[model samples]
Target chain A: MVNKFSIKNLDMYYGDFQALINVNMEILDKEITALIGPSGCGKSTFLRTLNRMNDLIEGVRVEGEILLDGENIYKDIDVTKLRTRIGMVFQKPNPFPMSVYDNVAYGPRAHGIKKKAELDEIVEKSLRRAAIWDEVKDRIKKNALSLSGGQQQRICIARALAVDPEVLLMDEPTSALDPISTLKVEDLAEELKKDITIIIVTHNMQQAARISDKTAFFLNGELIEFDETDIIFSVPKDKRTEDYITGRFG
Target chain B: MKKKINFKEGLIYGIIGVATLFTIGILVFILGFIFSKGLPHLDSHFLTSQFDSTSAYVDVKLSEGTENPLGLILGEMTLKEKGSIEKQVIVVKDIEKTSLAESAVNNKGQNLAISKNDIINRIEGENVEGKSVDEVNQILNSINADKVTLRITKQGGGIFPMLMTTLMMIGLALLFSVPIGVLAAIYLVEYAKPGRFVNLVRFATESLAGIPSIIYGLFGMILFVMTLNFGYSLLAGALTLSIILLPVIIRQTEESLKAVPDSYREASFGLGANKIYTISRVIIPTAMPGIVVAIILSIGRIVGESAALLLTAGTAAKIPSSLFESGSTLTVKAYTLAKEEANIELASAIGSVIIIIILILNALSKLLSRKITKI
Candidate 1:
């Protein structure tokens, strides 16, 4: 399998406090890679560094190389262009206070797609791909925030997909969702990895085992173990990974 | 524990009720006072007509004289002061006016066999019989072949012009201040790094807000009016008011911008939007309510502003022909009318109109904000 992202000796700091320490991982193209960890385990931090979303924080120091398609994203790539290629969905659903149609078209519009017919086609296609077209086609002009939490999250996924990104990063996207919504998102992620690379940070180990092909276990800013999901779930090399997986201590 | 909580809750509820009632009562009393005093004087004529302080109409009686009474009034008449009545004796000028006055004499059916001096003497008589003021004015109006030019002094020049000036000043002030203030706020909230200079700037903004409006008036007088040679113009007043409103707008806009969730910014950025695009598209739309509140507050301040305008935009009650000309706003006109003319009713009428305008503005902005939030 071709590698979409290659990280080497990654370290991240907020002011003087270290959040991510010497993390190395390869995320494969057209595959689902799940990062699972306990609370404050830096799994989400590692997810943010992929698209350089961490640059918004004040006094943030990063010492690492994050390469996307053989180009060092941290050094050579323009952050805005890099973000276009790597999309993100936060844990909590945050739809812009706008119409559902506008929300889906926001990304395309931002990148200078001004034609109405073009936007309409893109909105329909993206919403269809995000699996929300049937649920929302009639009320596409309605406010995005007026929808239910699950539907709004799906709309956000549609919004992110409207830009046609190469990679999608979801940071505990299902944590705020109900069980049904969580299953729907899991299924969506499973289907989406056929076309785009996805790196998800999840606390639900069973969810990680169910959807992800490869899983990386992190503990206290350290990558404890990384292997195929079945191996990590059944016979992990590290005791900590095994303990976390078996529900002894998370 | 439940009983103790009930007593505390009752106390708090009582306090809140009293506070709310006190606020409502004061508002009712002020509205009642203005309406009662102002409603009677708020006619269309009072709102539209123009008058000057220099001229007045006086009633004069004519005594019976022997022979032809030379009945003609002309320009440049000399008046002798009487008890609240000024009797003016005039010589004849302009043959057309002489003919008009002759018709008045014929209408009264009096014998006109007198000289101009005799006419003057007759007009000065104490116990003379003559037409009433209204009757004379009617006769003068009809016979003149021109029009009645009653120089009614001590009348208000209407509030319409002052209202226009007030609106214009507000528009100009908002135009000048909103952009600068919002941009400055954006810089402070979105772009500025935490440092000593940013802290100092914040402190300066706070201090500017705390400064009295009178001080702003003084500064405006010196800087805009005198040094800039604006000469108490509308532009000067708008510039001065913009400075006064700047700190408030900046602070409120900053607060509103800060109130926008970090998640929205992240979402916008994650879509490959740059800082400017994200701020314009996401952050500003969400913070629009608070920004509008700031603008409305600034408008309220501008509308009620008198002292600052009196110093910067001189108390000329006439409509300004251009932005560079001097004019009085509604509040300044109210102050001038109340103090100089001592016409409390006219001032109250102006105050009432101002209140109505502000109420409309507030309601419109609220409706607009509601629409924005709904979208």
Candidate 2:
């Protein structure tokens, strides 16, 4: 629960095509780590591997040691439990055709939280932690779809937190929203890092630099560089990282 | 000067427009004639009645104070063959017009009592001297509607029972078609490996859809009715409807499943849920509107069917007590009324009922789907 994910020699393939190769990294305990790369450069692929999500695809094969808290996840992990522990928020807000309160409580219910009072407390606390409680408190029973895009996204973040996961994975969570919504998610992510370790896959280099403590740059399924956020942006060791950050070539 | 313009294109455009209009006009004319010929029979009794096709019964009262008045023909037959005297029959004023047996007693509740002069008058009335046989026959066959009326009533059945049967049949069919169709679609979208077997399964599903309803009905009869000893039951009718609806359900559900963007599935799986859970919770709910539309179309087809139910479900106009009972549906009633008695009015009334039912069902489905698909 305290220690975070450690991935080593991770390889992923879609049939004969290689999508990620030799991905090695450690997500620090209770810290925000940013995965930065161009589109289709395997940063999102790396984020997905933490939850063993790629296994759902036909003809997908993985060879990797993805450990959560010193336990090898790929060897004997119950993926449902693994996923509930490492909760994820998606690129677009995917609230259930349900009330905002129910949307936040879904993960906990799936994990067998049946008492209404317990679920109510969890929903409230999670929404408050996501910094969206005040805006949505009066209308929790209304449909989540009626909310603004940013509020919906925050509700989804609240949904992820309602299960009390040790880690939260965000795969370009603000990519589908407007700038204002993105700013809200960025601020929420900044606050969430106080208690939970956050792994974010982002295309925006400036957002990664502004938010995360550690930053890892990837190029063509390979990790080009990994360093502290300030060093990765200001004094990176690799030329590819510098080129990608400066928008020279993808 | 006019001939210098593009006459060929103008002629082609005029011809195409004329052809399209003509085609539409022909369809409208055919429908209009059939409906107009059929629509007038719409009434409460017409809707509620059935055709016995056996006989016409009328009680002939000797009308007013002329003692022992003569029976007469109305000459009101629609079939006008000028020379035929085939339907000519002498009838006594003391009997019902439906049966050939003359009564031994009259309406005064007295026995046949004829005086010598009365017998002589009857003997003279029987002769057709100086008259054509057909003319004389017309005179003898007419009956006054005020004194006696002959209306066609069903032997032992009406259309209401059949209306209930068909509704239940369609409901069961929808129940059968929806869940399996959705699951098959989910498998195709979320689970099936791309291969020869998968392609063959998809092709089979499509082929099942194209099979005619009559063929499905026959199969249902053989499999569910005769072989299984269901004996013209609602289950058999429902089974036939389900087979007919299967292709429709699968095709629509598959299209809807495909319509849901792949990103949603990826989003769900990324949350660590399995493929099954993702499909049931996310993919299916997202594609539900199309599935509901498909179900509505299937229900329409099932409700409008006649030929299929005729063979499998039987044409007995009885209330079904159970799924095993032979029952007639509204479509079957229409067919029976229109053909057996040539009663177009009752047929139209039935048609109108069927149309209203289908419209209500489709509207209800659309409303429910809209509610669910509120986003």
Candidate 3:
């Protein structure tokens, strides 16, 4: 099976300070991969590399190959096309200043979906995939701001899904959400991995254990461990990973 | 025990306190005085028409005499000092002013007239009965018509045109300023790389704001009026006001755009939105109410401006048929009235309308700004 994305000897920088150092990872096709770490860890920075989201930040530079389906995305590939293939949801629930339906349609519209019926179907299907359709379907035309934090987060997830990306990258997607919303996203991630590859950066160890097929641990700008989820939790290869999961150190 | 505030701090605070109170006191006093002196003359004719010069010189004639025609059966007109009587007499015999040449001053300082037509004609109009234009002027020289007693009627200063002029100028000014300034701000905030050039733009905008409005006026008068050949027209005033408002729009819009979290921009980009699309669809909309507020403040500033409009927009008090037509706005009208020492009541009424317009604009801005967070 072809790996959806593979990073080889990647390093990243923000001006003089190094954020990720000599990192290598392969995200398997249609698999749920969880990146677990403490605060200031390079996990989120590493996740941003897959879709080249870090390009938006000023003073950011990345090194080495980020091959998505065998093509180095950092090379001659169109960045816009690259981003369209890999969707992202952020930590905070940032719905656009529009109706909930329009928020979902934002991505599809950007990729050029103008027919109303197509957008409507995409919005419904995507929202259902994100597990927010039943709650928001009645009032999709209302402002997305009127929704609660959890609903908004799910709406953001639905918005990302509407673009039909093959890969979904979540950078601490549940950090700003409440416990119930976090569980809901975890469950949604589980179901989504059947059709699309998902790489989630998370601080919560239990969520990593419950939803992931593979686990990668990062600390101080380095990939500390990468292994099967159960073994990594039960028998981590690195002392740092063991220490972190056991709460002896972070 | 804790010591009380030091004498120096107390003195500093006391000075600030006194200054605040002094400002409040002055505003209260001004408002009271304006409301008192100007309020009584706020009538419908004053609200509806231009100050009639004919109101200044009334003609009274007695039918029994060969001369007096407004039928001066009663002539002495008076009000509490702010009002006085203007008189002229045209003598009509066989329905023609037979003794029109006899209109002159009596020994008692009151105007004695054989005919009102001769007196009325000298002050303003033509068509005096049986008198040549020169003969009418000679009679006016000898008449006891007191120019001092000529009260320009408060009913004459119409608020409609000046009010319309102020609105149109402000509307055009906003139309010119807001789009360009706001787009510039969006570029600076979202797309531009930070460097010496951006710094220069920032400095230039700030400096432009600090440039006196009169300088803007002079530039407009010279450039748009003379060089561009627009003349002292609405377009000239609007363009001048737009320049004056540019810095304000840029600064306010920049601040408001900056207030939107970087995360939103990142999210938009992460969703594969182009820079232009993100700015136009998301950032600008989020920053819209703030831009509107900046526009409203610009409106108030432009409406209250006189010196700027005086040089750029001529004080031609007539209905402007087109953008190129010479026009006088409310501020210009108030200024001309005050300068000529013409009707204060009329001028005060114009000032009151300006205030009302500013208040309405502020309320509208407040209303418009409420949608940003919800948008």
Query: Under the 3 Å rule for N, CA and C atoms, how many clashes does model 3 have?
Result: 19
* Per-residue lDDT value at B327 in model 2: 81
What is the TM-score (0 to 1) of candidate 1? 0.82
TM-score of 2: 0.78
TM-scores of chain A across the candidates, in order, are: 0.99, 0.97, 0.97
Judged by lDDT, which candidate is best? 1
TM-score of each: 0.82, 0.78, 0.82
RMSD of each: 9.3, 9.8, 9.5
Q: Give the least accurate 10-residue stretch of model 2 chain B, judged by summed lDDT.
A: B115-124
DockQ of each: 0.53, 0.31, 0.45
lDDT of 1: 0.82
Extract clashing residue pairs from model 1. B67-B113, B68-B112, B68-B113, B68-B114, B69-B112, B69-B113, B69-B114
Best by DockQ: 1
lDDT at residue B149 of model 3 (Cα atoms):
18
TM-score of chain B of each: 0.68, 0.65, 0.70
**What is the fnat of candidate 2?**
0.39
What DockQ would candidate 2 receive versus the native complex?
Answer: 0.31
Cα lDDT tens digits, model 2, A1-250, are 3458788898999899898889888778888999998888999888888887776678888897888988888787888878878888888888876689877877776666789999999999999999999999999999898998889889889988887888999999998899999999999999988889999999888899889999999989899898899999999999999998999987
Docking quality level of the chain pair in candidate 2: acceptable
| lDDT score at residue B206, model 3, on the 0-100 scale | 99
